[model samples]
Target chain A: MNESAISIKDAALDYPRKKKGVGLLREFITGRFKKIPRKDRWFRALNGINLEVKRGEVVGIMGPNGSGKSTLLRVIAGIYAPDEGSVEVEGRITLLAGIGTGFNQDLTGRENIKLTGSIFGFDSNSISDMEEGIIDFSGIREFIDDPIRTYSAGMRARLGFAIISNLEPDILLLDEVMSVGDYEFRKKSRARIDELVQGDATVVIVSHSKSILQSMCDKVYGIHNGEIVTDGEPDSAFEFYESEKE
Target chain B: MGVSENKVLRRDGKLPFLSAPVKIMQNLYNYRQLLKHFIGRDLKVRYHNSILGYGWSVLEPLALTVTFYILFAILSDSEDPYRPLTILLGILAWSLFAKTFSNGTTCIQRNSSLIQRVYFPREIFLFSKSGYNMFHFILSLLVIIPLLINYELMPTQQLILLPIALIMILMLGTGLAFFTSILQTKARDVEHIVTIGLRISFYLSPVFYPLEMITGGRIPEQYAEAYLIANPMATYITMIRSAFTGAPLDIPTMNLVITFATTIAIFWIGSIYFMRKERKAVKFI
Candidate 1:
């Protein structure tokens, strides 16, 4: 698993976006099938995305909206199938891309922890053991027995983040790291990310904040129009990103 | 980690993305947990809105029994001697089937947030809905305490068979629920169609009247037996209803055979179909 690590070759994503060229009714009827005709189904959300991240290397992705960043993240996580190529993840992978999104609002925090852990592939006994660690980290002990719907956004995010961290994946994927929680909780998340990267874990962070890009990531890819327009050292990627803004 | 970067793309035709068999095996275990989580959430949430918390589990069913007791006693001109026990089991059993059927059909769509984002075995949602309703259905039957005694519908030693019969009914409800839930996931219109189907199923089953009384023994014996075989509940209710009537149930061998076969077949087919489509349930949502 260590030598094999994670690699992607020629991976691509395409999503159909409706163009307003035709009459609404005629377009609507055809839209029910393949839509936009066979020639135009592809928006080419990610164009031949290729990369190799060795064990324990921290990889960061910096991009604007619709730059195919999250699409690439999902591809690596195996949530979406690649149309053009394949991804080989040697070890177990976990994506911390969502916060409490899989949590059931009707379930208590304790129940949700077990249910969510199982949903992501852990067994029941492990969930019970991990429950304490999850609860301790989130600092929401008193309300752990309460339903998640009662929790505020910060509280829910803490729980979601805590569960993802408990997974301890060899390949850890993060999206919009700065946007996780309130400023106070975001500080906690940053510390956790730093601690996780210190281990043998490989991390890929997707963020638009230049400060984070400069401080955390050694390697970065500046992407636009669904392609990696620049790939190199962090400073170099940012230099290309800045020039693109003009 | 993978090699042959330049020469390995030799396939003439593309295959389906995920292996069908492996996915089914994985989903079988996955759906069990999903069933637990979804049902747990529903059971907890249902009482959260009520001041009674969970006593509504007992209170709601008891109230329904009382209302029916009064209505059936006064409204019907020609009430059968066993009418009290008849309405009691009939209404409770029908409610269980109806609730499980109607709600299970809509479960995959209802939990789009949970299903759409993550990959999970889809039948978990269906099983959860059925599991939650079964909890309520069981709690509701406890209301039969006074209702049974006041009407002198209290049973003989044959009443000990009540627990076994109830378990069978639960299995039947689960089988029907699992089958219908998977069907409805593919077709949005199936939800509406199922609601109507449940109502018709209630009439078709020997819920309200005894099968013997419904047709009168005038119908040929083989046809009546076949009808009973086709309807598991017809046999189910006929035997169990007499638990209240305090009479010996001449259980039919053929009826039991049909009940056993239907239960196993539905579970097997329902699980396979549900597993196949389970991955895509979230995608559609």
Candidate 2:
């Protein structure tokens, strides 16, 4: 009955690192990403969060490190589900796994371009059509046919960002990836964000950069200790977040 | 608390990629390409500094095959001239299986840096091993061609089934791999134990010799048969040998049932455990 497209209720996240005691035999039975042994040692990455985002809205979450800022983003991305509470999400969510995640070091730049395009949901045939645009946007025309590993991280990031930007998702999540590369390129990334914002897309950005969130976010919440300490104006949230800093 | 407010704007800007969860699977489907990229990366990285490069894939198995052949051909007291062929079947299957399983065992742990932060599906990484291992397996097949020619063995219509046979090995590998990748990542020593386990299994599995070789001419027939069918890797090697020898596989129709059921069960348990562990895998790294 709720009209909100995304909702989280009392969501909490805990992660286990390492622990001793489980008999030598049972340890191998556990999954690497599970929280079986860290019962006492687990870090409460995200405490509890209550949120609702409707269609055609943009929300920003900002906080200090370990304040569940990135944890919140990861939970929403379905990378982590809350230990408790229900997370009901409607519509499409686009989670960027970074620029280099979908690229190959061994494959030629041409091959990497196609590979990246495919990860954006386009088929090889479709990628071939967009080949020229990818090369142009990346601005590494000469290296387009070379293996991507030979390219610098900047070049790789540019190529990666270029591929995803073309896919056009209904909702987009960014995790400080835009902060990479040069100032000129960051400006380009911001401009691209503007393009997505103007459309029907809903957006969520996680960052420690107050100025950037203040300038671009319509509403921002300061998340601390796994709960929303303050929610409302980005200026006020940032102010509250900064004042609370010890 | 609700996004329904029309004047919700707090005079702040917006967030980045608002719909990441909804896009997880969508991105993953798109990730088939990404998976290929990773597989390509692994293969290239493995061969990077080597002289023969990927030719090593073919060469390694070939050399092992030769060592086994020479020992059985001229050195063994057994009069069976077919001993060379038998050893070839065993070594090829064993090495590939051991290499794939052990490599996959560390697939996630080695990449923990990326695993802890990234929002991509973890299974895709487990699946990436499948891709890379299979690629290497295919490259190794190049050796089979020359070996076949030297033996004067003609290609058979049954060779079309080779792809199917290899898929079975991978499916079996996937079950062990998917399970072990998660298990070892959670428990560090699991990989070390599995490394030794594979070594012992190489000697125990039907790879270096037929199941019949293990049971003397005096052992009960059905019991040895049962062990071959039950030992996880045993059937895999048997089927592989069947591929080359053109034998009937002698597996019960129900054997496929067992393989199918175990495949699903291992994959199901492994995925559940991995997903359960997904949140924590990040913390360790």
For residues B1-285, write the lDDT of model 1, one tens digit per residue.
101111111111133233533544554554565556566667767777665876766665556556766865677565477665576677777777677767877776676655534444455565566678878766666766776777766458877656656656666666566655654544556667777877787778767655665445657877777777677776667666766667767657766777768866665665555545443333334
- Report, in order, each candidate's fnat: 0.11, 0.14
lDDT of 1 at A226: 76
Recovered native contacts, candidate 1? 0.11
Candidate 1 whole-model C-alpha lDDT, 0 to 1:
0.67
Per-residue lDDT tens digits of candidate 2, residues A117-233? Answer: 544445557777778886777677888877777889998888877766665665677776465478887788768777876678777878778876776677898887878887667
- TM-score of every prediction relative to native: 0.72, 0.77
Report the Cα RMSD per candidate. Answer: 6.9, 7.4
Lowest-sum lDDT 10-residue window in model 2 chain A: A17-26
Worst 10 residues of 2 chain B by lDDT: B2-11
Candidate 2 docking quality: incorrect, acceptable, medium or high: incorrect
Please report the TM-score between candidate 1 and the true structure: 0.72
